[model samples]
Target: MMRANENARGRLSWKVAHRAIPFALLLLAAAALFHFSVEVGEGDTLAWDQAFLLSLRHADDVALPLGPAWITTAMVNFTSLGGVTVLLFITLTTIGLLLISRRPVEALFLCVALVGGWLSSNTLKLWAARPRPDVVTHLVAVGDASFPSGHAMVSAATYLALAIVACRFLRAPAQKAYVFVIAGSLIGTIGLSRIYLGVHYPTDVLFGWCAGSLWTFGSWLLFRRFLPSQA
Candidate 1:
């Protein structure tokens, strides 16, 4: 029965690979981010970070970004979407909705994920203590360390966590995909706006995105059982 055994082994391998692919990718991404974070912490990326930050500004004047006036204004507006006031309002409104709908468990999960994510973001900034890019003028005011962008991290955690919870109530695959796409687009735009505005280095936003995503995903896994099932 050698042939039969080989067929069974192939089927087992296929099943294992199918189940392992996503986890493998996630693990690799996390490892890469960690390595990059270390490099950043050791000041090994300073040269490239400064070069990249300056590339977005005109060589003649760092204050003038590499775009028209209207684009600068638009970036400012987009940046606010990830600001404290907007995120706070959204978080409160979401919690209210969940409570009213008798989904206390889901509400609690959102609270833990978002609140914990915020604290983690702040902690990372303090730990890294990476200064904001001095190679270019910051279009907006910023007073915190810039290793991990607070706006990017918080926005990714908030939007992605919300999207995950929202997708639970969606019955169709298209609807779920739409929710995810919107969330991802918002996160990407917010992160890019920070860089364009000269308030953060690209690496700061990149690390923020990675850390925020991992935190939210970890929170989801921890609370997935308590979250509502799909419609």
Candidate 2:
């Protein structure tokens, strides 16, 4: 029994140790992406961006992305997850679920994280004032600056932040893994959908992911300290 307990404790310690490594890397990666976004916005990535965006298109028919019509249709649907309307729906639903579970303070923290990320994305868009992709015809219409894909940033912030909350509700390893996997898949696919539709450059989505992740995790660190009684 003592040996089994020690083995369980060792596994727990290992999980904690591995978790710390990624958190440290997240901070570093966020800084790196922000720096590169600044450089790209200033025209340093002109050749690379054009090359990358064009690669995703058919050579003979550059207007269309290099995929079947149905795939394009599916990508459009997936991309909507990052759109304002869809994101708002997700936000409201998550808040409702948290309140139902008697986690009001955590729900509030979730709201703050999401709102802050959205505002930051918009502010950065104005500051950068970068133009939308001209490499190919956009599968969907978009209006506004495109230095960072708002859809990418906002979805990543919301979904990933929700994963942190999910960890609290899910105790079993399989349940926790499933929750994180779904959340991560949504975050990744939403970002890719923007690039696939020719609405955002690859760099734009990349930076958005970085910024969103940094903000989400940072908020979690703050809110986790708010004990239930204090909350």
- Residue 190's lDDT within candidate 1 is 96
Q: List the residue pairs that clash in candidate 1.
A: none
Quote each prediction's TM-score.
0.87, 0.85
Model 1: per-residue Cα lDDT over 1-231, one tens digit each: 999999999999998897667567778888998899999989888888889888888899988899789999999999999987888799889989999998887788788768877899899888888888888999999999998998999999888989988987888899999999999999999999999999998899989888888888877766776654643
Candidate 2 lDDT, 174-197, residue by residue in tens = 988989899989989999999888
**Model 2 misplaced stretches (Cα beyond 4 Å):** 1-30, 228-231
lDDT for 23 in candidate 1 is: 67
